[model samples]
Target: MNAPYADPSVTAKTVSARISPIGGLDVLSRNEVARLRGASGSGLHALLRRCALAVLTSGNISDDPRAILEQYPDFDIQVLQQDRGMKIELSNAPAQAFVDGQIIRGINELLVAVVRDIVYVSTQLEQIGFDLDASAALTQSVFEILRNARILKPQVDPNLVVCWGGHSISREEYDYTKLVGYQLGLRGLDICTGCGPGAMKGPMKGATISHAKQRRRHNRYIGITEPGIIAAESPNPIVNHLVIMPDIEKRLEAFVRLGHGIIVFPGGVGTAEEILYLLGILLHPDNASTPFPLIFTGPRQSAAYFEQIDRFLRLSLGDEVARHYQIVVDNPETVARMMIKGLEKVRHNRLDTKDAFFFNWALQIPLEFQQPFRPTHEAMRALQIYHERPRHELAADLRRAFSGIVAGNVKEEGIQAIEQHGPFAIDGDADIMRALDKLLQAFVDQHRMKLPGGTAYVPCYRVLSA
Candidate 1:
């Protein structure tokens, strides 16, 4: 499955022009522009370049983040302050981002998002003294990021569906996601996702047809991603609203907090990490009764994929962990129907509990889940994954383990770490380790871990039996 348009000879084309901001971002202070253009270590230029490139090359199929940079090595972006507003200038940008010498409207909007989030997180959060390390403080940061992006609508009902799945997935699985999205869209539900391709793109693609058919105005297709993973899994073209969180932890928190419900399609380690993250939070005593609908679904061919996932979850987290989620096989209509009913319950529960519909204020995410887990060699080995700890706590560690694997698999930093330090070693209870090893092996065997036509995926971590 080589990218249909891949050609090393297709060198990047340089474009230098000033473009006005779209949406709410119209102005930036001179200090902000300096920070964006600053070459110092603290500058936002590098971050801006990576994210802007990702949005410009929205439909790129490569999982290697470095590939894009290498292809467009001369690419650069800068923020220019003007009397009326701010303008963004691109150098050596991808030609695909434009049509007839003008940038596409969607790409322009996404580019603005790239600048907005980077500036806000770097300046406002730091200046306001937000404690990103504390759990409550971190959740507040996530909320503020979403609110600033105008993603949190006060009057909107609980209709935002967060779709999670692998960027690399079978065509059948992708099609199945579109079907589910169609059904969800027909019911007037908006979509949110990690904002990559495959399953993430499927539902949005499906929903657009339904949205058009229903003549639905102002439909939202939101995409949330972090800096580390965004380059590898670039934003899909359909995402109308895009927000880049500072890190993976905050990105995951943003999804669960902002989305009314979650629909998981077939995915690899990253998807497993997401499932564990949510289940960990839901299993916490405070969230036990919360009505957050969780569904794992795919086409009939993907039944075994979910089965393996179910087995792994039950084995490591215990059988009761199954109670938190439902599995729907090959039934797009039922999946959508069930989600509508689930969202209805969520709406009622929010009303009863006095929680905000746009954000799940009542869900309690422990500090362990919110704190960033840097996958250094020592940190990966120190994770406590035994039966003695609380179920939710163990789930957090398990989630971290998968998160590290995801980093090693596709993320640029993770790949560099593996290249320099070797594979990460994950140690846990013997039975749990074995189950984890088996599950990961399945992902590798099925080619779920990398792009469909890429070279063989080398293991990035080892599971040690206790």
Candidate 2:
């Protein structure tokens, strides 16, 4: 069947269908179902529609969240509460998610995930039943969210390798991520990512091939994302287990708590934000004894990008921070071997501390890293990024700065804010300002700030001369 309505602006075919629950998302409370079917205002229904559309349109190349919405303006979703279970109704949905009038099973499961996460977070979490004050409470909230999604495995060992990188990247960089992931998979490791395209998808794709070669069953390909990012960077098709966190801060924390190790690839400000957040948490004296493997690797041609990143880290956080990470360029096997060795260390540490293997209960994440950072104009201007503050504290604020830039580049609300008020104004110590400006300019020059297509890139934040 053809699309119900044609928009000259978007010629892509669309379809409408009703799908039953997949992966046990059929069970929902009546109140939850009502909220999902609420009026199309700022209620839970609106969030459900946006997230469900994002799942239906997985693998879309555009980074602008509004771009997809504009392409299929009439797309909508509704949840029907039945006597036995639930049903999802899609109107003007992306045709890509369907094959021969039937929704792809994986897409169906992800669509159910969209409904499950949105309803649970909006209804249960927003009611403040989970205390958000102390650091312990925040961490518990993250654990509960993952548990509700059925992601945390108590019996599993620490072998989930979280891959972090930008969705917008060069072909070489993306292929390199796959190579690293292939090596990791051959070593019997699972994969986790932000669940978007580019680097996030490459690793999982490579692992699928490797897992097939090894005849590995039940290989987990997990994708963790938040509402703000899913529409722009929809879950990559390779993700078998998808979890949508409440916010970016919780999403980042989830990555740290669940994964045994992390591999960084060529990326833009979002990747930078993740690195800063991780390093900041590790820098705390309480977490210094923990064993978390971190490796930065890319194609040989992308070595220069790592060099600049290493320089920025050294300058901003001091040379001692270098002790925490290893940079291995163009060596996927070596990266995997090092990860294996590091996981051994982590296993030993967990055993020594009597900590759970599934979650990093021993790692100390300060409140600075747990709290959400909204990238408002005022928040951006007020950040203090100088040497006067403790190194970890400074890293936390710097992570927020990069996070704001990420919001401006892709998220819908941030994009609109950038249009209303010019680029965010960021002024700090002169040395740090220069470093930040140089790093951001490199991203723009390399087409890392946005996907490589359509219009020219625009600066989202200004680095003033301090």
Candidate 3:
């Protein structure tokens, strides 16, 4: 017997490259650069190195977070201070990021984004008196991160559509995402996503074609990612504006806060986690009257997949959960039409409420949904998944449950913990556990838990019997 073949490890390639920053990220102070280069143990340099490697490996197919690190074990990045501006020095980088000894333009820009956001968040946002524990303060932190990244447009209409789905998806489902994106682009709407592959990449790819056909200029293909997931799911090539939030909670907040509407395609646990997060917020009493368009869409073949999702939501969160989102299957045109109508409603809602189009300030996100969820074995086992609590509260815990499973599946820390302590134990109400087990098993049966054509996926969790 032979071991499975892993991706070829990245041999150290040294390169000293000077490139101009894109999209208003050209200037930085000496203090920021020094912090970026701080020692691996005490400073942001390790985070910066891992994230920079992920950006440089954009468009990669692997889902293992440590795959890049193992390949480029010696790879390191430095922020070189120059008289005029700044430069990046790469010692032992992935050769794929370069072509004939010159770095690819898009990859270079994304690498710069990794540095820019890491520095800004570590020095300015964290050092400032921003409170991550409070809802309003957390939302303010999200706004500051976006404003610093230059993604917010003050005068633009409600057009940025945030696409959410699994990075691991089928061929048919991936194509459906592009078709929906094409329709949205034809209507002149920009796009935002988790900034990885599969459904996340599909809409941007589709919209680019439509934008080209319409000859529309200044289209925004924005991507929002976090540190833990970026290493496994590298940024896709189509993202013109890339922003790295500090954690999964802030990353999700950035999406809802920045986009006018949301489109969800077929996906696995990660997608389910996203759906629950949005529903939990929308189900809040304070947010009952707010209007934000959310649609679950896929090709005709995925009708069953969406049906399973619908059943799980109705069963776990109650039947009324259907009110917050719509399910449209097999009709890209209709999906686009309904989204346009929904966007109009969103526009009028913003106008009537005096909210900004670039960011949704009125949406009330509870502190539970705003705080970062660390998915440890104890955390996974401690989740209260019964229906005795408020529906919104139940939804929040359920969201955390799936979020833990997601971490165990691909996140570096989660994977290592699982390796050391065995699979995470998830104890909940018997019926709820049954529903969750069924849904997750279905994901495995359909090969949604891991990237296609890779190694078979073993369960990362144990559902405790009632």
The residue-by-residue lDDT of candidate 3 on 1-466, one tens digit each, is: 1011223443335343445454456767877877788843446999999999999888998889998899877877888777766777776677677776677878877887888789888878867888667789999999999998888899988999999998988899989899999999999989999999999999999999999999999999999999999999999999988999999999999989998889999999999999999999999999999998999989989999999999999998889989888999899999999999999999999999999999999999999998888998888888988879898899899899889988998899999999999998988788888989999999999988998787779889998863
Q: Compared to the true structure, candidate 1 yields what TM-score?
A: 0.96
1 against 3, candidate with superior lDDT: 1
Model with the higher lDDT, candidate 1 or 2: 1
- Cα lDDT computed for each candidate against the true fold: 0.90, 0.89, 0.87
**What would the TM-scores of all predictions be?**
0.96, 0.96, 0.95
What's the true lDDT of residue 284 in model 2? 95
Which candidate, 1 or 3, has the higher TM-score? 1
TM-score of model 2 vs. true structure: 0.96
Ranking the candidates on lDDT from highest down gives 1, 2, 3
Best by lDDT: 1
Off by over 4 Å in 3: 1-23
